[model samples]
Target: MKFKAQLHNNTVLYRIAQSLAKLGKTAVVQLSQEFIKFIYLGESEASFQLFAPIYMKNIFVDYNIQSAHDNTIYMEFQVDNLIKVLKSAQGNETIAVRLLRKQKKPYLTFKISGYSRSGRTVLIVQDIPVRVLTPVQMSHIREPVVPQAQVNILLPPINNLRSVAERIKSVGQCITISASNTGKIKFHVASEIVDIEVFYRDLINPILPNTKEFESDQIYQNHLERYFSCTISTKNFVKFLYAHYIVPASISCVLIENHAIIFTVYVTTTAIGAHFEDQGNACGALTYYIPAFAL
Candidate 1:
């Protein structure tokens, strides 16, 4: 079995590895003709999945997979080790990765080549045993009922969010996020002695799908302008904010009452000189699901 690919954007690869490392040490990577995916889980049973569609031009110079019978290749590797190697990338370098099976052992070789006069570096990492996880059926999970009270608001830049979270994290074990239909979102934390609320106003509220369903519900309609709040662990929430180093084009917050608060990060590779204006241009999405804390 042989698999190789040339990655056009080293920064994107580095960022993805770094983000995954923050969630878990190991991840299952799937390489096929259609897309490349990295899957892992975090706290609160939250799962993080990264997808790089093969259809994107300039993303992958060459993706070849040759196996005995199957066209897909599944492998497991330490995310932190990969991130350490990828950290050496100077943002403009191209990454080449090749997988080989030697003596019944899998090895991954990474080559980082700089664009300027800087020389190239090659590193070979021997992969541990691959453990394939059984795929979970989405239909098995209970879908949050429609007309559920949810507030969709655009998040501030990642750096800003992280900085704010760092300050308020120490004050409370969990952070409360509250949103109102009047175009306002608040990050609040309250202790026995003190209370803190950071308000972000004048932000655009994304149009939720099936608005008519929510409108017909009297409970949600009456409190439509009232604040809807959800609490999530401070530690886990801070970790999710660290993905800002990847410089996602946009991050949106969706708070579902009695459900989960989901952050959808649209990842685009700036190393390729491509500006992602909308979801259509995004190479992948890094979504963080933080289950709501019981009130």
Candidate 2:
């Protein structure tokens, strides 16, 4: 998202209207008020005020604005070609000098009509400050944070076992062991394997502990041990899942007002024949609740 800052022109216009309404029958106010009627194409009188430095007194007295719509006011004035001089003034300073110098800028006009003890009053107008959009800017955004931990698991020999090994190599850590009855196959990834290593070394675990490939005694569980660690960065981890067929699960919840929840959990597809009542299978979601030990 982006942000833009500009003057609340509508509020400034309202102030101008209020100032004119206080002018009563003053000739200067009356003339500006009269000019406003023609510009606004309406008959309405409103009070307005214009405050500026003493040096700018004449500017406010002679300057005028007309309403273009329910929320817009405009002015017309001329300025020298020096944009630097024009950009220095802020808010009132900008409007004051622009009007007094008759800089080539826009003006505001308002429609006004009223009747006082003296007689009819019309075109009550005043000049107010405003701003416009100039340039666009861009900024960088920070990514989200992710907590991490380590887990060791026995992997199954899927079709893309080699691909999985390569992924683990990128992380620089991981250990996988595939056991079967026909023979025993052990695997260990000492470090993350990158594309360059494919030329010097095999991507797959060429040796498992003592076995070169598959051994019948080691297939079921002949004590084939391997150690590997993976340093998973958040970005790479997310990309890995994106490349693989394995999609993470998702859960969504909506809650209103106060609510409470206790333990909750999930069991993976490869989980041993476990019961849902086990602590490892329970997790919790709550709208609001205090911890049991908080007291």
Candidate 3:
């Protein structure tokens, strides 16, 4: 009368186990994606009776409890095997019934021995839901919101610095890059950084008008960014690039705002006095153009 289910990945299965030790009648159970049907007959002949199927198909009649503590029956049907049998023999009752009764295939073996009033019975089942994991492999997820005015972007590499830079450049935007003190590098984007973030959100969380469901990562990388730009304070920008890109701490201060983002990186061999190298470590600036469109 009572059931519990276990789910892993896309597969799910449920079982109704017996609690009382005294009852020993064999239980018969049938299950499908939509429902589970159980039967508890007083005799083997009654279990195989003509009305068994009809009673099962509409068995949610009335019950004080889904399963009485000491009077409930349980069934475990082999889900896959049952589906195969049912689908292949939709109208072939003789073969289906024979297989159900004779074959010892791995299946939902019903264990139906419950004590109930002479004319009273119980049945219980529920629908199980399944969810598929999104198959997205994108590295960055975008956030919504954009600014109306121009925004400056200062980016330092966290990992794979060059690869990240290359991806951004591929957006066909012009980017100005330069070496700075220690081992830091910087990039600048001209568009409002907020707008870029909004674009990224759309790319990462695409909406489908038809199904009203988010699109699966399986479809395609609809809008991967070839480039990005961020604005950072000079000091933090140095740390950001160093920590993320694995660049040394000596590099600092990239000037990254104009018509394009520019970096005047002062690469230094030593941490000390690196920020104040020859004439205050003012390296030549590198400029890159920002792309007009989002990936």
Candidate 4:
């Protein structure tokens, strides 16, 4: 197997690592010719899953992956370690990722090149050990599949939502979110003595894309007057906000009534100095979905 990618936007990759670091400790990196996926599946008490995939053209200028396992490779590593090394980069640095093996053990290495303050060139190499997944192990992992969402409302700025969620966390263990085709989203928290609410009105309700998962009959065209709501743990909601540490190109709220809440983050992947890539057809790059029952 061979894997390598030249980083076109180092900040995007670093923020991804940071987002994953807050949700779970380990993730499966799926490397294919078309995409690089950072996936986290629920086990034990996790009750949540993260699916983040970058379009090959957006981040990797020079990308290659070859494997006998149908041209894809899967590896598991510690998210904290990945974030620690990535934090060493100072925004001006250039970073590249590759795979290597030693003594039958695999490692994912980052090669960072930068200039020092003293007018000197410096290259930093950081290697984190990883567990390569066999074909059998890979077959058992799958992304979560959900039915069509009842409401998909374009969200207010994530930072504003995060700030509200954090403050509401003190009033209750769970936060209730209500959204509708009315172009409004309201978050409510209730305690014995206090009931607090934050509302974002007049926001746009983006046109839902036509996909197999959402058939023509399943769209929310008739529900413009109704509100779909779900309650999830405030702690988990706050953690999900970490994904927006960097401003998103687009972020939307998706609710399946009493079932789940899915936050789709379309990262701002405009390559520095380049025009904004048309992401109209691209699926949400990062999906953070939490089941209501899990909390």
Across 153-244, the per-residue lDDT of candidate 4 in tens digits comes to 87777778778876787898888889887788889889999899898889877754345544454454445647789888887788788877
In order, the Cα lDDT scores of the candidates are 0.66, 0.24, 0.26, 0.76
**Predicted candidate 2 versus true structure: per-residue lDDT over 1-295, tens digit per residue:** 1111122222222222322223222211111322221011101221111111111121233443333232222232211211222222223211322222116533322222334457644333343322221212101111112222111122232324446555554544323332222222333334333322211111222123334444665552444332222222222222222211211121111111111111111212222111223424322110111111111
**True-vs-predicted CA distance for residue 255, candidate 3, Å:** 4.4
- Give the residue spans of candidate 4 off by over 4 A: 44-46, 91-96, 118-120, 208-222, 271-278, 281-284
Model 4, residue pairs in steric clash: none
Candidate number achieving the greatest TM-score relative to the actual structure? 4
Task: Return the TM-score for candidate 1, rounded to 2 decimals.
Answer: 0.78
- Identify the runs in model 2 with alpha carbons over 4 angstroms from their true place: 1-102, 135-295
**Per-residue lDDT value at 143 in model 1:** 24
User: Which regions of candidate 3 deviate over 4 angstroms?
Assistant: 1-155, 158-160, 175-257, 270-295
lDDT of 3 at 227: 32
* Model 4 C-alpha RMSD to native: 4.4
RMSD in order of candidates: 4.6, 28.8, 27.9, 4.4
- State the weakest 10-residue window (summed lDDT) of model 2: 286-295
Q: Who wins the lDDT comparison?
A: 4
Show how many residue pairs clash in every candidate, following the order shown.
0, 55, 36, 0
Q: Give the Cα-based TM-score of candidate 4 against the true structure.
A: 0.84
